[model samples]
Target chain A: MNEAGTTVIEARNLDLTFQTNDGPIHALKDVNLAINKGDFVSFIGPSGCGKTTFLRCIAALETPTGGALTVNGMTPDEARRSRAYGYVFQAAGLYPWRTIAKNIKLPLEIMGYSSAEQDERVNKVLELVDLAGFGGKFPWQLSGGMQQRASIARALAFDADILLMDEPFGALDEIVRDHLNEQLLALWARTEKTIGFVTHSIPEAVYLSTKIVVMSPRPGRITDVIDSPLPKERPLDIRDTPEFIEVAHRVREGLRAGHGDDV
Target chain B: MKQIIAVLTVIAALVVVWYAACIPMNIKGVLTEQERAGAEVQPPSAKDRRDLSEIGLALNNSFAIPATWEQDRPRLPAPHQVAIELWETTVQKKITSKRSLIYHGWVTLSATMLGFAIGTGLGILLAVGIVHSRVMDLSVMPWAIVSQTIPIIALAPMIIVVLYSVGIQGIIPKAIISAYLSFFPVVVGMVKGLRSPDAMQLDLLRTYNASRSQGFWKLRLPASMPYLFTSLKIGVAASLVGAIVGELPTGAVAGLGARLLAGSYYGQTVQIWSALFAAAILAACLVGLLGLIERAVLKRMGMAQ
Candidate 1:
């Protein structure tokens, strides 16, 4: 650790279980991870691999059945209460009735930001997302990619220091996903904010993240933690480089090993 | 242009058919039979008598082209006849004249509005309660559905009688009946609307740590607008039915239902028809007005235009 307080997210031996009609279902087991401040970390795993569950726990949406998880050095619940992070769901989740501007202002309004400041922030984020002229439009009128961009702008509007994104670009086509991944990288660089992204795509995880946390299913646990070799200045061409492919191959090997498949 | 021309052609064909049907091909006047019995009868002009009888029948039937086409058809009074009667009763003699439809219409409108407000309020409250509690969902929803199954016509008189015994009359009784009929749609619509938010959106709000009231105000209520407005349209129409049904009992002197009753008693078919038409028009207008408000509110919220 660089400093005692430098870690933005730290979870130690986290475990989660659910009660079912048949019996207890172990969802997560003995997962440990630490994310540094301003780091872009992506968690990649198969279905039921607890990637989303872990993200939820960090966001305080789910309680870990065992172990301790802290965000910004505070308990998940406290951090949630303090609004320490902005969460972006897999779906856009834009309120259909609210305009683009209003949707972006939702968190700001809830946090009681002054109208002028809210408008200022909203405008800035809208411009940042390249949706400045579409402020008056509703979410339903926008294309899927545009809606996702709006959702990102919404998260950015609150100016939160940490972002917990659960497959934010999972629903987009490959082209849109690639485009969004680059834009997200650019956004992360500009904001210098810590981000925890959950995705299943190996290449996507390898391309965007400074650190990759590969997880395994069946009592989900971290299988590998791969520090990316690529530089901070990532461009679209970086995806085609030998270094990017090597990281992606490592991630694939890690996933196969976790699944007990020959690699 | 094609549609308008087709409609005009159909209307003109109907008029010709009506004129042909009413030409009095078989003249059977009472005077004609008497003249045929050859007892040195001083005969009136047969053609003149037939013409006079046809004119009388045309006047009675209000010169409606459709009416003259079918002998056994229910009397389809022409638009002019109904209009003439409506003008004489409503405008010539004002509402106090006891024959005025305006007075009856006001009475019915009052009852309908009162009932509509009460029903809508009750529906919203029940919907909120149902949304908040599982017990209310299990208990109140089934009974609300059952309440609608009880015919309004059957319930109206009993409601009137019950209210009368409890020292309630006039608007209250009528309003209660209207509310009873109108509330179910609002409840159903509102419940569906309130629960409309998707899992992802709800999770987003939960992640934000928004309170229950904040979530409801920010998400649920706004999400339910389209459903609520659609239900209000149905509720308003139902309330109008309730008001009319309420008037059927107690023989109220100043309501459209009472006008219908009086028209039936005096065999003034045109009066009853006009009153019925007016009630329909009022209900349509009320629904239209609510639709207008729905559009305005939704537009302001940046929903669909």
Candidate 2:
């Protein structure tokens, strides 16, 4: 589980309630989690489970209304300002006006990286996403899967120590999603960066993570945290293993328990 | 090619309709002149020859219809007369001649171009303000609405008189009026464009910890291009209208509005129609230029098809 290092992200009794026009909607409540360095943790829950909200908190894109949340031993906002992590949103979110290379260069430009450095970083990240020769194409000119990879390249360009991915492969079909998952696992293995991935897919969660966090909605709270015993070097056939099946069954049970709590 | 053919067909139809309509409108002048000519022809009972039946007959009888088409001071001039007048003033006369439409058209074009620049600058500034600050959005938008509601015709003379009183004359007041007309569309379009980025795009910039100015430069401004050019086209046309209206009250000696006034005073229907056509042509060219610019810029940015 990569427990040899200090914690990268720590949450304690975190609460977030959005005051919408209808009323106060509880998004997260009494959530406690600790993610150590170089660990791949997946947050798996159904819709409205605040799994996305929790990822947003880590990126400081959303503020927690109560309790404490920390990234890299500092406030999430500070960590964000210091460029601690790269975030991949659900949609590619590439600026339509920019080519793939330029889109990846956005963060570098924002950070005032030199033109040469920006170019170097963009090339390296494009290679990382396996989109090496497609840098000159516009986002719309590329296939949807290619566009998503370009967005991942954009996030990875600045060489941050952590990557916060919000269901990046959720929109893809099974085949492309499987391909991306394998590539992501390979990328993670090479980088050894802390990753907090949010997803709704049980198989995806089981396949990708060293640790899995199952969350419940209607006042989102952590229902269970499973430390998978599956080997780190998992192939596509790992899902057939009895141990993998057992963990997947436990995750399915945790999800059912979450639905039962609300109904 | 199809578009050009379609446009030409529409224009040909319009000319045919115009020529037919002129026979009815100018029939009275022709009938009276025919009576003066002492031709022993029985005049159809056409409410003194300016009625529908007489016009229909005139359309059929080529011999009699020529007189109506050639009336000295007809209610409606024939399409050919207007065309002839336009050719003579624009092509036959020297450019600097008092009789030349070119001189007047140049004046109006100058004012339109000047006003468009001012309005574009003011619009972009106001749009930036509105997008960045809530107070500006609330305050400026209502005032912009009020400004438009106050009729340009009512506002033009007041602007002229005030500018004259302040020792400002000629093109500045006209440009100001044009600027006023053009500014609103720019403001509205630019605001929409600047805010065009979706929630996810904005959140992405925030994740990068980009400042507001960075957000504006990197995302908002570039996104607003298509909208800006569209508004600019509308604004430029409105500016031309403003410049012409500004010429109206002063009874200016130069400009297309002056030509319209002069033609009206002397019962020169053909001249007025010609001047109106010239103005319309000028407007088309301006908008066409904007379209060309839009294509080049959007294509460069990879935003064009």
Candidate 3:
């Protein structure tokens, strides 16, 4: 993976412990990974496994108490300050008070993008996410799935090379999730941007990722890293193939193994 | 339409009940006076008293009740008396005249408006400061709460007297009192509002590497608006109360409170009732105006329908 191209994100023994009322909560421990340019990486794990936390660290939304994590050879904080990545949270998290167009333009407004540039980028991303005609509407006016798509549009609007998404469609129903998953694949095919995705679904991991990083809870650690053997351009029916099933099974076993440690 | 009908019906019923109540509350006072004005006839027969005016005290306990429906100094002035007084002072009299309710109302309204503006501005500033600084949060919040616990009436005299001694008198002192009453709700509301954005939203701003000032202006401030308006509504009503209370200790000769003092001293219950009603009406108007602004602003913000 390191041989494919220049590394976009590198985490060396990354560690984060949160000081809580109960005591210290070990959110991440010894997370070592390298994400190459234009790679689609999915971090699959159960809740409390630090998958979301790992994604946040890459975006500089959280600080690793120990270890070195860098984005594009810059510290995550520096990269963040330099407008390096666009992040999408678990929920759509659109400002309900703002119209969809304005919501998508929030980063642009903060980053001081010209109004013309903001409008152009907002329109482009809205069309990319298939929410082109709905930018005038507010988030609450849209359905849950549509709002999530709008959130994706918001993340895509800035033209950042890296998209850090934390379970962006986790709350959606299966039907919408499948549709979004396909749209997301098409989006990746078109943009060729490096993506860091967090998910709990095994099939989603196997279907979407060039690399799947499995994580474990309770002092959250990466248990296994599996490089996928699936074709780059995969259709929805590919999930029924033996190759896809085999990769999903491997991810499942990796997750079950992590759970086994708790027992 | 339905809501209007319901409210009007309630008002009408209240006035009816008020008119009915006037009979009992004023009847004893009415009858004793009527008895005093009657011709001396201690052992008079029913026929002797019948010659007196119909429904008079000279009925000699022969009838059910006297029809003394009107009295100049009744315990509870009839609804009509208050209405007539409200009309005579507000509509017929010139607005600038000392005898006019409009003049008194203007004096009080100016104080209320000035105080509300000051209180809201101060509360918002303090709230933002409290949200941004742990020191302000720890030291100022407790005192803000403590300030509210001291009743404004007790504080009013001291505030007025101190301001007077320093050559700041009249409206400013009253406005200060109004400001005191309105401060807490705005502080409480704004703090809640400034902190309303969740962890995820904060993270979104952090990812942008937004400045703290930018975070406050773009996110926290707008987010707190719904809360801000709610507090403003509460603060407006409180400000009016403060303004009226502020007038009491100063022995104001021109505001609604002055009218109340004069009415009470002269035993003009009608005048007092009219002044009280005017104050109530003023408070309602202030609150209603804030409600309209809240709806407009929140709706524009897409926070309300």
Candidate 4:
């Protein structure tokens, strides 16, 4: 792993304006932030707050209209071409025609990995996501939570150093979401990869992140970026602790403050 | 079981309606035959019979009911006449014999299958090109739509003539016509299907920096399967029609179309009806085969739901 303090993603006055028939809408505006190596960073905000857009930009799925955004000191597009990160969308988005293992092998196939190595990596990631035995099943055969886990495994199979997720658990029930959240934290701990997560949940944001960036809509921009002082090794019960509650409160304040500007 | 029973009920209703309609149509011929046989008949002269309604004649001559259904050169063959002809031509006659419906059916089917294969192959290739290239989509799609607007019946004769002039004879010309009729549905369906993957699915591949070919092979092609099968069912039926139509203008000596034409020339209504039934049955079999293949494939792909 790179040095702990080494910046993996840096956005400097990032601006994205989308021109539509109605008018120009700012998706991200004057956004400035830094995500260090191995940091679990969560971007929390309301709908249209550009939280998802920001993560998409990091993955190079969307291009910023103006300003500089870099991943691992390279342009997002360049970083993407280098396969520096894996992305999980809100939906699992598994191809129905393929088994979970085959879906996980998709990127490896595109990148021209050997057949044997592809299987090995697939098995490893399936195990990582607690879907080891379920690899033979198709996406439709699995429950939504299990399907989402398989998708996460697919993203991890390629072992990119950075993971970008856009509300990956947004569709799940609360119980399943909580369970996946704990599993995700465990996975992140084992992998030690930098993560950029976009979500609307406060406790989830507080529970999972080493740092939280709260954002709002209407010329979407960040209101505050808080570095958590909580210990890295956190359990599910950590949410009950005063420190976790304090950070959660700060995140809520930042979200409100961002929303306050629009109203 | 309920669905099968429902289908059988519908078929039974149609047969009853068909048998009822046969009475009025064949009554005149039945009357003529009976008059020739010197039987006592209302409106004794043929001219008088022409002025009288066939239904009225049938009501007056209730004795002629069985005769109406058994005429050798009847204007409309009864359901039993067509069925007997179908059964005899398909089963009693040797398959290799000229009189055999199976032989004619095979001739038409071979052309349909060949044409379907060519059309589906071309259609999928064109669809892939259209999905990937804006220029192809603009240029090729309009022509495909325009091609289908010209009725196959109107075009079949010209195609036969042109192909005959080129020394291309027999099944190839018919297959070409079949391909022409079938290709459009495939192009339309496949274009929609190949474009079926949503924005998020495409974006996932983009995040992986997957090449265009990768996107196509892994995403677009497999996604198009359900659409492909639907269009194939339609295409295969269209192909049969094309093959049958192609046979009509060419004065072909064999196949179901030839049998229909020959039967018409001789006023052999039974033969024509049998040939028509054979064609219908053949189309059903082709479509049913496609449905089976589609079900198995989609089930294996885990998309059966």
User: How would the docking of model 2 be graded?
Assistant: high
Q: Candidate 1: DockQ?
A: 0.68
Winner by TM-score between candidate 3 and candidate 2 = 2
| Model 3, position A11: C-alpha lDDT score | 94
TM-score sort, best first: 4, 2, 3, 1
Where is model 4 more than 4 Å wrong at Cα? A261-263
- What candidate 1 keeps of the native contacts, as a fraction, is 0.77
Q: The CA-based lDDT of model 2 is what?
A: 0.91
Model 4's DockQ score: 0.83
**lDDT tens readout by residue for model 1, A31-115:** 8999999889999999988999999999988899999898888999999898899998998989888889999989888888999
Q: Which candidate is the best by lDDT?
A: 4
Please give the TM-score of chain B in predicted model 4. Answer: 0.98
* Native A-B interface contacts kept, per candidate: 0.77, 0.77, 0.86, 0.83
DockQ of all models, two decimals each: 0.68, 0.83, 0.83, 0.83
**Which residue ranges in model 3 land beyond 4 Å of their true spot?**
A1-4, A261-263, B1-9, B39-68
Supply the TM-score for candidate 3.
0.93
* The best candidate in terms of TM-score: 4
Off by over 4 Å in 1: A1-5, A21-24, A261-263, B1-96
Which residue pairs collide in model 4, if any?
none
TM-score of each: 0.85, 0.96, 0.93, 0.98
Candidate 3's DockQ is 0.83
